[model samples]
Target: MPGSPPNAPCSMRASICALTCWCSDDTRPIRSATPRSSMRSGRARSSRPRPRSPRKNGSPRPGPHASRPRASRSTARTGPGRSKSGSPAGPCGSIRSSPPRSGPRNGRAGDCQSPARGYPRGMSAPVAVALEPCSTGENPLWHAGENALYWTDIPAGKLFRFDPADGIYRKVYEGEPVGGFTVQADGSLLLFRVSDFARFDPATGSLSILRTFRDEGMQRFNDVMADPEGRVFAGTIGTDDRGGGLYRVDTDGTVTRLFRGTRVSNGMGFTPDLRRMYWTDSTAKTISVFEYDRATGSLANPAIVHAAGPADGTPDGMVVDAEGNLWSARWDGHAILKIAPDGTVLERHAFPVAKVSALCFAGPDLDQFYVTTAGGGRPESQPLDGALFHLATGTRGPDRFRSRILL
Candidate 1:
């Protein structure tokens, strides 16, 4: 793998730094009912890093699952939790080894109503209100100003924008493996593509590279966020999960390294008051919190905010809502967790899909939350893999990630 050195402890450089960057979700979720209490136990420590799945090995295999074509279905009802065969349906309808002959149908084959439907605690399943059938869809960000949602498909090397206004969508950029993006004050987007930060002008078809980062230019940016002051903070990941770092890019095009040794840095967002910054290392299953100095765009007092459960899932992308609550996409857990500021999981709404990559809020009132779920390493044996999903949390997210001013 590129950018990784054997026996290295995730430093600034890895022996395989020359390899290509790899983007895959490997986070374990914390799913116990207890908070501040470690309920799930019995984890054996391993000196070597976890081995890559054999199926995902090689030049990088295509996402295994294929999705059905778009089908118009009524959003009013999500049908019951039972399959037509009178069996308890798993998250996805019938788990057939083959893909659904027709694309996703809206009725209730394994469909559970939304939380608003009040099926029962732990019984309500997340409904897919909107979906983008992109393979390997990862980072999801809700741009309130545009009244749309933006996310990236790393393997596909494309950026997407969905305008809820008319349900119109556009591919803003292509040929760049964009993992995460932050809006600029001028409405342009700053994105990291294969270890370099660049300003992308969707309005004009131009990509201006600003600077190169970790792995000595061997890594690609994975996830990023902008603070209230418009400073861009992002992370990087290499092929072998080594030499990834978190960096800050100023509006003036100056980039500074804040922290290094991150393994697949994923989700990021600031607290409601903008007093703290939260980030996650997907592979490590660790989420860290930092005290922020808004006046200077610096961070201090780093601490582990939450370390997810190993078997449940790991943290992928995260966002803070208007209520000062934090919501995280649990990659393997098959759910998105709503967490309190102090790292308490207030609620978790399970998704039919396991690879919930990232999330954002939309709808007429910004109360509707949109999530991008991936098929993990390979496409699922079942169809409906890599499908976009939407849910109405009836909650609002914090003001959009304020854009950093571009020079």
Candidate 2:
């Protein structure tokens, strides 16, 4: 990247500021962060082709909708009283520093250097998968057949898919706030919205309702996942007095309620072996595990494995990795928690902004992590709070189970 432009675009700059880089030289004790409420997570790799220009979010300056970042001491601005030279605005609006960066950079921009300090220096910084943040980004899914990533902005009622190959993305649906969705065995998307389910054709952008609820008002599919047998376990954000419920939607169209006591049903995932199912309840601040029966599609022996105390952030969306570990997003916590199968807090990847809503593994090899966040539509949200981000975590993830619900 020797000839790379002096002014990196907003995507690269945004990735830098939010990066919590680690290194070998500096040895500092990791301080304990008091856990609190939370929710989700990015992409750059050498194996892929170079990215195209950042046209959608390449604005060097902050727009009326984007949050303003603080200027770097070495940044020069073009306006009247500013120096008029240096890099562009980064995440949340931070200006790029004029000084040269040293070390090995993980992504395209330059040498690897942490925007701040502390932690083993990783090889790369988290990449901004989507510069345009969401107002409730959740449910990231990697479609190997299409070689792309898909996710939703719940409040905005928009669905988007991104191609890692060229750094290009397009909005696929815009009529409803999709709480969760799964790629069908045939490759179409089965969208679970507020009160109904839709079959979405990504290729043509055409969608048709699959099912409609009669009395489940406000009982949206908050989050869900397909079981190993093409069945889906859908959790809901039920009405005030009723509380959220977890239901099973089978291929035959018969629905069964498995559990019915969560305040806000959030994320769900299967254990690597498919023996256990993990569920998150944001309002209850807990990640519970249940005995999963793939043959019967029933859940039993439910137990609270990881309960987030006031200090620990509320667990939002979650997924199981290839290693049998759980990676969960913390709402308002500003970090993603990597939890062990036994529910131990293994590691925490911090974010620059709050409202980290959800994440998933994407990329051809399934080694990259794509994250989503919320609060993008709010005037008080942080710069990158609503943006979709990614990182090349040296870990592979399990394949997402496909839903085969008959229409």
Candidate 3:
């Protein structure tokens, strides 16, 4: 978030500048799926000026229920569908919710397979895989081609990979702080950083700027995911007074701004059926789902599936399970939550570290869950803090779509 890109082109700034700069003239009215209350301003400095008018109140308010997030809604109609319980279901099935629990039921495996069988010697807790701790370990991605796992230490500007077969993990790239990245179809990397988004090659340590932000002081990228069509949806972090933005980088090399005032867009994933998309806004404390249109790459009708309570730690990176359930990592809560579609807490997997940043299903069969942690650079660091964790679970998640950018 602090560093500037030393290598970037000048093509992207003009068209996308008005979107984040929040200028009054060119700032178009967006059909935001998130509520205004959840949105904060962005920190990107805008050189343009706007005339101010006297306002009696903060901003004009919309009518009642006009922008309220719905708790229950019908699912997208990808095709014929049925609940896991096997009751005949509609294409637009709505999940019924149980009352929220005040606290995580420690060691409770409501529906997921227990961790006891996931370890070699029957160790139930998550096993840390790294020898040293990362400053802000995040963005755990599975590279199926290499049969290994990759993650990043954001503050340290380090990228690392772990091979379970030989029990080896090392830094692969060390440059500017990389917020997130995706594995390309050709095995290259699409890196989203503070100054620009680019393509990175591991074998030759080569990186080329695909597009660069016009402004160097804009917020840095945070999390990104490749859609079923291989388009990437990326988000940026918010600054002190402003929220960030959510953007879609098309395969044809077009950039589109999907939402503004996004407060720390942290994680994203698609449903098993590929008809819906799950998004997390950490500062808003809400996980929202959208009806997705794969043909045109758009989202609509956002509903809050899970809203974190005061006790629920800030939600960070997230992924959808094979069964469409969502697993979210807690920043300060020291646990990973497996949540049902109806927003019920199915399982709570606790870790020794306080900052559980992100997780993904990896390995050949995609049966293992790789996790990342943060706060390792702190003076009072724990043994496992900032280390990558590998847990062999009973479930398998779908492979992330191989990116085909600039197609």
Candidate 4:
């Protein structure tokens, strides 16, 4: 009746025919309470009908179906494989979502999107160890000879080892913060402690000083590794009067300065041919490569290979795989990036925790990857914040050569 043509009679017979024609084509299920007049209103009034009550912009008035009930927000589908909430089922069959976050939390970026779809076939989620979590765990080292794993909690000032055969974990040393260490040829440990370097013999529980840095103006040692020929390459973080420096400690305990003027010196690794060395400067957010002379313990022709942006997170510890690729732990990136020899990103493995610190290949075949994390200075608790994790990599790693430096 509201939109009848001027010459046509507004009769029930014509209205019912128009409404039937219009209602027959609509595929949406009809609501039981919809009125007959509303159905008739949806039809075209006539070929030359006048538009009634036109809005300012000339759009048609909203129809009765415009107020139909919408699908519930919780049941809506956002994309092909995602729910309305943007959380999809993860590899472990668990719902995982990345809530909106502002900036880096505890040195790590916020949670990332769901993991890339192409994780290696049959690779399960990382498994966390049941041992006590550390305040800040770093430098995970797998000792193949002893069938054990070793790591340090820097802030807690404790060194720990786990025996997989018997499933036992024990604290080997507790004192000044241990930044890093290497397993000696005779099963002893050469420890790089807060203010000095020391040797600890597990059999006798004896701690002997090898060198002290009381007046060097260095804050503490950060990372240390042994070359194939037994020379220890160690780096220090500077104090008020100095900048960080990289040093080469020879078998005879002579420390030679290799490089200086950095802020935080971290993970180091050598290529399979021992011709190139990779070093990380956490404060600079860069990983650099150098032409290395392993025979002489010299580094030359330094060049930046990779630099992390503000969102990529800082590079921490690293290890060279058998194929000469570098696997680096990203402190706040929530992942480990496998980089090619020429600085190409080959693959990435995401973690549940944000502060992924260090990783190493372990197990008899070196096919297991062990990862360490940090929990210090976090605003909220994470499921695996400071726990040790292991994943089956399906690839073997190079055997760790003992640090031959005599103590």
Q: Estimate every model's Cα lDDT from 0 to 1.
A: 0.62, 0.68, 0.68, 0.66
Candidate 1 has an lDDT of: 0.62
Which regions of candidate 2 fall more than 4 Å away from where they truly are? 1-124, 214-218
Root-mean-square deviation of each candidate, in angstroms? Answer: 16.8, 14.3, 23.8, 22.7
lDDT of 1 by residue, 1-407 (tens): 01112111111111111111011122222343553433556785668755546564456433435465753333333222233355533433321111111222223343322232222232223444333345678777766556666777788776766544433344567775887777777777777777677777665667777676655533678888887778788788856656677888887767788877656888887887788888888878888899999899899998987878665488988888888888898887878888888888777766667678888766556665668877633434223345556555656766566666456
Candidate rank order under lDDT: 3, 2, 4, 1
Model 3, span 1-407: residue lDDT tens: 22223221111111111101011222222211232554458876667655556567888655444777653211111222222354423322211111102211224443111334222221134545453367789999989888777898998887776655544455567778899999998998888888688888766667888887632224788899999888999888866325576788899767787886655888888999889999998878889999999998899999999998776688999998899989899999787888898777666666667888999988777767788999875668765577677665556689888778874
Q: Report how far residue 42 has shifted in candidate 1, in Å.
A: 42
Residue-level lDDT tens digits of model 2 in 1-407: 01112122222222323322222233232223444323322344458555455557765544446776754322211121111243333332212221112212344333222332332234133444465557788898989898878888788777777665544455667777888999999999999888777788877766777777534534678798988898888888877636688888889766777767666888888888889889887877888899988789988898988988575567898888899889898888877887888888876776756787888877666766788888775667665667777665557788898999884
RMSD of 4: 22.7
Winning candidate number (lDDT): 3
lDDT for 358 in candidate 4 is 89
TM-score of each: 0.68, 0.73, 0.70, 0.69
Q: Which stretches of candidate 4 lie over 4 Å from their true place?
A: 1-118, 214-217, 240-242, 376-379
Least accurate stretch of 10 residues (summed lDDT) in model 3? 13-22
**How high a TM-score does candidate 3 get?**
0.70
